[model samples]
Target: MNYNREDELKFRFNQFIISKVTGENKDYYSKLTIEDFVDIKNTLSNINNIITYKTTISFMDWLRDHFSYVDENYEVYLKDVLKVKPSVNGYDIMVTGKVNIVAEIKCNKPINNGFKYGSAQKNGIIKDIQGLLEGKTKVNFNPIHAYKFLVMYDFGEHSLKATEHLIKNIPSGYRGKVEIYNDKTQLKIDKVYVVFIK
Candidate 1:
């Protein structure tokens, strides 16, 4: 059967629990009900959520710490790691990589109010790009690279249209590219790669 990442993780977690329980009480395995498995799945989901949230938070801190020092070219000691800093009120994860390519990384899941062409998402991204261009937003480090928007989500038709709207609205000079990524794509965290050019 086909399994997503979450499903695989839950299955492995359940197997581990089952093995431990069977070791302690062999009869317990036979006594387990569907409800018990459901509970285990829910618990694993919650744990995964917590871990993902923490890891996201830690990534920003890690970027800051790792790129704290730079040589004359402002490149991080780790050649592939991009320089990052906080952005405006709504935008987050500003990264500057090789050749002064500056990008705003926006991450969203596929469900619920994921990144779309909604007013909030559109305006927020526009504002961030405008702010960066106008030098209104305060950044820890300045990037001499081109501007870009790095969107991490499973794009739908609406999302594609929204991205197009965003790209069209940006000022001519700062309009660089919009990179899209989903579960199927292999994202390399070590280096900043441009996926599309505006």
Candidate 2:
């Protein structure tokens, strides 16, 4: 199985994500040679199905076991959640799944964000989840379908656990609670899908 596209895309995305996360606002594209991206794209165009599956699983497992989420909030404001976005979206990851089921990628690292002590920055994540939940609950989207939360963490298990706690406690107004996914249960995540790439 060959995962050249996946690998190349991730390599590019890593450069992009890290720059954004660390306030390195320089244009990364300017530094790249056409041959580099072409190679990655060609690799993806010829991606093998077996490689795709194996690579995806391996990537997820590495993420789960190797990194831990640390707190880092971005300056972007999410109006729906009425708070600044967390740094999770800017991590060295790229997510590709159905937009409807996929929420933002997050890091499960600890920080001194305003909301809670050493908790994952809750602003954007909560907002997106809540918005989706409200949309489903009010039949804005489709209430009949069970609402799900897909939290993709970068580093720590603590933030992952914190997300699980918040999700489990979604207000009574909504008919569903947040469901967390790991390697063991990721296959079961047919409802709402989230992919975290790094």
RMSD of each: 10.9, 16.9
State the number of backbone clashes in model 2. 9
Q: Model 1 segments beyond 4 Å from truth? A: 1-98, 108-116, 140-147, 168-198
Model 2 ranges off by over 4 Å: 1-100, 113-120, 135-149, 183-198
Error of 2 at 5 (Å): 47
Tell me how many residue pairs clash in candidate 1: 2
Per-residue lDDT tens digits for candidate 1, residues 26-80, read 3343455889878867877665335433443444444444344323333332333
| Reference-based TM-score, model 1 | 0.37
Q: List the residue pairs that clash in candidate 2.
A: 67-155, 68-155, 68-156, 69-108, 69-109, 69-155, 69-156, 70-109, 93-197
For residues 59-105, write the lDDT of model 2, one tens digit per residue: 44444353232011111112222222322232122222222222334
